[model samples]
Target: MAWVKWDQILLPYDYGGLNVSSLKLKNYSLLTKWWWRFLTNDNALWVRVIKSIYGQSGGLGCNSPLPATKMKIFSGRNWSQIINIDQTPSKLGCNLSNVFVKDVGSGLDTSFWNDIWIGDLPLKDAYSRLFRLEVFKDATISDRITITFDSPVFSWAWESQPTWRTEDELASLTNIIKLHKFSNNSKASWTWKHNSNGAFTTDSLMQVLTSLTAAKLPPSSATDLSPFVPKKVGIFIWRAKKNRLPVRVKLDRKGLDLHSTRCPVCDDDIETLHHSLISCKFASNIWDKVRRWWKFNQLHLTNLSDIASCSNPKLVTTLGVSIWQAVVWVTSYYLWIHRNNCTFGKNIDSAAKIFSDIQGKCFEWINCRWRKGALDWLSWITNPCRFDSIFTKNGIG
Candidate 1:
């Protein structure tokens, strides 16, 4: 049957000028003659030969694996020299025969084999399974041609697969230690706790002492001693550790003065860092106007430590913290300026005026420096009548 089909596909393309009878009468019989004809024919000959063997129904004959085996032997020799060889139709024809042999040898039922041979499998399932098998995962199709070539499958799987590493590639991973002798004549000063004969034992104290010696600041005629002498070291330490409290209480005290060790806005007793910042009556009023202008409630900032240690520290990049810090700094600067005005110039500005100045200055700074995004501060402060004009002028909305 196969010989009859091969004759029909190859008889018209023979170039030997010999009649079919003479060709058949040669040492090669019909099949061998047809095989010789198929190989020696033009490029179109392979397509016709494959069609004749497999037929329009796309079913490989029981003996189709033989040609596939021959093709595989031919492919293996110059394997590396072939580029896009798998994308040729002849390669696919060869693969079809190999697939059939694999399926039959694996003991798939005859019915299942018939379905696959005739291309009757569900399209999605066929494609997925073909992809899952490394054999067809990297197959490529060009025009009407389909090709499957073997890749470096399992050995280089690490390069093919995705993964993450815990440590950086740049780690040096080494260790070293050493010791050195000490000298009493060394000029290094000492921390009182580590000194035996006025030389430092700890690394930090030794560093400080060495720096002081290098600067020539120890008992030297060139160094000024007036600034170095101190009367209230213990008192300053006690004030730093124990005297601080919230700003609001200090703001509400009687007769509070900036120079009298009390909050000027509030005459609270024992005025401290926290009391001077958030709790002062002047600060509270300023924060209130700021919150209203920004359409946010005043942040309950209790102490300077809260401002300093906030996890999301204030930066020009931060929207809310940046705005808040701007307000705080401007308000502090204005209050100090007002204090100077009161003491030296004998001029006083109302808290409302101070708050207004802070808002105006903050908006000016933000508008000048922050050039991206439509932040809430912009809309909240810009006059409604001039909002569109400002946006158009600045090329922003």
Candidate 2:
């Protein structure tokens, strides 16, 4: 659950999730610029500094001649070089194994066997048996090419004769390579694996990290609340869904010295995430009022997670279900705010007032996204069901 909270915090702003940056992923993103600088901007001061430190040729003020080829510069430094200047390396930094190259053009600078130039994998990886039998495993693109005055011809040099299995793999490799024709004028470049264009963007990097850790966390079944709800409400609902908001019961379970874990509103039982958000006396009253308005008396909402995942497939259209889910999220959010105001702000807002807050907020927020019909407080209260009328099976008008 703690991990889920962390993931929630790390999610991007557009997703209605918290904005927490992972330094490890950020460092990895920044390091991608290293390849970018090496290929594109050799005159960059940082590139020159790096080249000088690693004892590579070609820099701004260097008397030494440029390396025979770009491959020499690539071969000079290991991708996982550890350079500690004034500060030590952070344990948070992402591993080098996660990084790979994407060939943009000639594939000249990339290692033929090692780099991920073909598809989302390397030729060596796709044909491991052929890779093992290769005589020149570390050979670069320039080494294998036959340069004529007219145009460069491509060829491969392997060590051993192919068996039946190896022949099939070689044929497959030949077919794949035949699809990508190299140009003499084009230079091969490296790109981050996280993005489609092979460029490094923060959003893409965060998404990559989020996806990598997604399997360990419980999947969120919540509907798309970002289009209708406020960001604060969305975040509150997200926290509620994850069961990560700091309720007194959780504090007590953590061995914290608490006088009591009773709900501030009801004072009947432990102030658990479920009770405070759904089943508490105050929360239940609020939900009852909302249910009466929405006419969902049959719907059973036992916890915030239930509200988060309110989808009725039996309905003729998704608009009603989506609107109802948003209402549930909004109601639960205000109930929480009311509880906090009572406990921490030392002011008890009535259930009527809290429900009113929900109504006002939902109307204001949803109006921003809902465009099918004119929405006023009168129409909202009297014709709550009609909110779904503004939308259809396709989507909102």
Q: Which candidate is the best by lDDT?
A: 2
Error of 1 at 214 (Å): 16
Tell me which residue pairs clash in candidate 1.
86-147, 246-275, 247-274, 247-275, 247-279, 248-279, 251-266, 253-267, 253-268
lDDT of 2 by residue, 82-125 (tens): 22210221233333333544454654555677655566555677
lDDT of all predictions: 0.36, 0.64
Candidate number achieving the greatest TM-score relative to the actual structure = 2
Q: Candidate 1 — number of clashing residue pairs?
A: 9
Worst 10 residues of 1 by lDDT: 169-178
